[model samples]
Target: MAFYLVELTKSVTVHPRYFHAKLGDHVIGRLLALTEGTTSGRYGYLIAVVQVERPLPPGRILPGTGHAVFPLRYKALVYRPFLGEVLDGVIASLTRHGVFVAVGPLSVFVSARNVPSDMEFDETEQCFTSVVQGSEDRLEVGTLVRLRIVGMRRDATEIAAVGTLRADYLGVLG
Candidate 1:
């Protein structure tokens, strides 16, 4: 549906007496878990899943006696709404109007009529000019593009929205 709060900073002991938690952190009580892909960034880095809500106190850290309070479970992995969803993005930047696909960690918007119809828009070197010009290749600016999620809009603050790869296998992925 719609949920996002992600925040663990970094510190997860993992199964040391039911996953004893510590290290400048917290994990509020009761059920908390989320995990479902993407978090490495070749393009978008989107991976999320959290679970922390108890279990502490075991051997270790007793010299001065301090460390272990647990109560920090924020949880965030939001994106679950693209109106159609067919993500596979790259092309981090390109502008004269559009081309910004990063699909999953959020950055989707392939305007300029969703590029790829032989791509042409050189109002005299404004941008998007490559119907095979100069022969070095085309789709410049970190190209790796591919998109498909015709439309998606959200208001009431702004989670960000706007996507269109034109259609079929989307475009520019070579």
Candidate 2:
């Protein structure tokens, strides 16, 4: 439920020639150039710039640098994951403490404690395995898994999540 498409106002600095009647178009171009593919600390990934509001007022030039600063408003689509949200991702790597999964722009870790108690790490194979009756269920690198987000931390450059595979309908998908 963390996906959102909403309007946001941001400042863009451009050359004075872009300050005319078609200012909105130039602002939109510059805004997309700056924000697309960038991760906002709070908003998560800035996926797409959908629309730009019409003609913002021309901004004034700075004393030393004659750059014009304009406030541009626009709508965008962003993706973020919340606690308890179940997501599917491929196992990227494994360590003694946990395994890391890549879900789009986010990287999630499923700690050893969060894995099912029945499963144990296999050092030789570098995978997790569980003996269920007479059968063995295994999880290895490149395996598809369904996990629930237990915790999250965000910084200027990245987002990290702590996940659990111990719940019902959670763990290796196939």
Candidate 3:
């Protein structure tokens, strides 16, 4: 799910104190500070700011402010999960409706309907349990599980995922 070497353009404001000979370094530092660990609306999570391309001339200083704004072009590493991709994560919580698994920064929900048909919710234990032949399987908080991304929904602030563990090899990982 990690995307490497993606080109991007960003605008950075340089304070007057940083206008000296090390201006390029200052600008690059500012760009990394602003973008590293930030999420892109189009891309998923930005892991790091790898490199800065050719630096364009700084734009005109703002009136009365004396700060220079520069358009910076750069490349970054990002992580974006795609639909139908299978991932392993720890179970964060269990609800009456489903299980919530935390996969890095992403939270995925595997609805009750998406769990294996044999599994049933155990209200007293707050977990899902199933018995196949003579063996017992259980899924609870902190359990490691493998799931397939079935759907995703994103808004301005967050991304949510719908997952399924009903398929073969897609369940509690033991």
Candidate 4:
């Protein structure tokens, strides 16, 4: 899988289909910057250095535009998809379900099942709280955590993820 940092050249109106697209979603063409038009229509222009995910589409010649670049179906390429991978993430939002860890551009679901049982629910705080859950101090909302990926699935529509604080290195951080 290749990684490309693309700039929005022309303001392309993203269809509803594009909004919910996952992190690994793909795009094609030599992504370009908008010299004139806005990315507000069904289609616009861009200069992208895309890693062709499929055989190059049939090329055509457009007026003014040098080449009629074929629209290539971009395939989402996940660079890292596995357990034990260390990710820099933050506590996005929490619920009875689990804590949502925002790992860079992706969100990781750290389930309650993965949290050490030693951590107890604080009725006052409404969040799972623990004084010493096998870490330096505690586990609570807004606490910086150093977690190890314990489970993950990339094929699913939403990433199935779970983390752990059961190891020497995996736990709450100061």
Candidate 5:
């Protein structure tokens, strides 16, 4: 996965109730609501609003509705991942079954079936653990890990991926 900064122009619509002194803020807020955290094939997942052009553009009110539409140009940070890509992620959550890793804007699932047999779920400790070379290695919440993208699905506002920690150079990180 990778993040990219790009300039984009999006049309943001604001309700009539928000048409006040700070209409610019309202418009930009609406734009952020629509774009941020949303995923598209073209730009992937729009992470954050980087900048908004100064002196907000004029809005055109619709015919039947009183909503104002503004063509806002702005810069944003986006994340798009590819198959077979190796990426570093933090273990957001873990279970006896598997773990959920957050890689940038994408959440990847590392299934237990794909995990190495050397590790096992420690019910008492509530984590995946292993011992090698007289040292203990644990996979728990907040653990840093590296994985390869095995499969992916892009939805309207989300990018779901299935990752594996069994490959070479993959797995727990110190």
Candidate 6:
């Protein structure tokens, strides 16, 4: 699956200066800013802060600096790419080694080997081109392509995937 809905809890710390009447609002604001758009190995990428659970508990305040650490619980929409998934994306960049496709917030790399056998990388032309059925096809930057996710790797802040366009239904799209 490309996207997943998950629940997450995070500790939102409020500084002493902003620890006023509407401290809850401040913490909630911090929560959204910190959690949304972040990626974790376990959670993939946080697409949105779906909703924050209401009636936050009175959090514990650190003694040393008077900073309050509020345990915030909420539901979020996250994007997680899975193996064997077919996704359509725009070609973000083209290189001699591979093509980088921007599939939503994820960057998928389609290496030279994963591309179709008939397509060849032409250094002078700066694209992957092929002649098929009396027509010329070109794969270049900004082209839309459909690829299958063959492998994936997760990092602390992003998810990377290897894609292939060698299948019958995969490759450049209109």
TM-score winner: 6
lDDT of 6 by residue, 126-150 (tens): 9999846664778899899999999
Identify the candidate with maximal lDDT: 6
Candidate 2, residues 38-82, lDDT tens digits: the string is 887788888898877765666768778778888878899999788
lDDT of 3: 0.86
Q: How many backbone clashes does candidate 3 have?
A: 0
The TM-scores of all predictions, comma-separated, are 0.32, 0.85, 0.85, 0.52, 0.83, 0.94
The sequence of per-residue lDDT tens digits that candidate 3 reaches over residues 1-174 is 556668888999998998888998888898989988876557887788887887556566888999999988888987787889999999999987999999887889999999899999989999999957775788899999999999987765567889999999999896
lDDT of 5 by residue, 41-132 (tens): 76788889999998888999998999988998899998889999999999999888899999877889999987767888989999988756
Over 4 Å off, model 6: none
- Per-residue alpha-carbon lDDT of candidate 4 for residues 7-124, written as tens digits (9 for 90 to 100): 3222222223333333123223222222222221112222233443445344344566453434444322223335677665667767776787766545677777776676765667
| lDDT score for residue 127 of model 5 | 91
Off by over 4 Å in 1: 1-38, 41-50, 57-59, 62-85, 88-92, 95-98, 106-114, 123-174
Off by over 4 Å in 3: 54-59
Candidate 2 pairs with clashing backbones? none
Candidate 5 Cα lDDT to native: 0.87
Cα displacement (angstroms), candidate 6, residue 30, comes to: 0.5
Candidate 2 vs candidate 6, TM-score winner: 6
List candidate 4 segments past 4 Å from native.
1-67, 70-79, 131-138, 156-158
Model 1 over residues 1-174: C-alpha lDDT tens digits?
233545543333332244333422323322232234443222122344454433433324323434333333445454455467666667677776887766545667677877766677666555575676664334556667666766755444334557776677766666
Deviation in angstroms for 164 in model 4? Answer: 1.8
Model 2 accuracy (lDDT, Cα): 0.85
lDDT winner between 2 and 3, please give it: 3
C-alpha positional error of residue 12 in candidate 3 after TM-score superposition, expressed in Å: 1.1
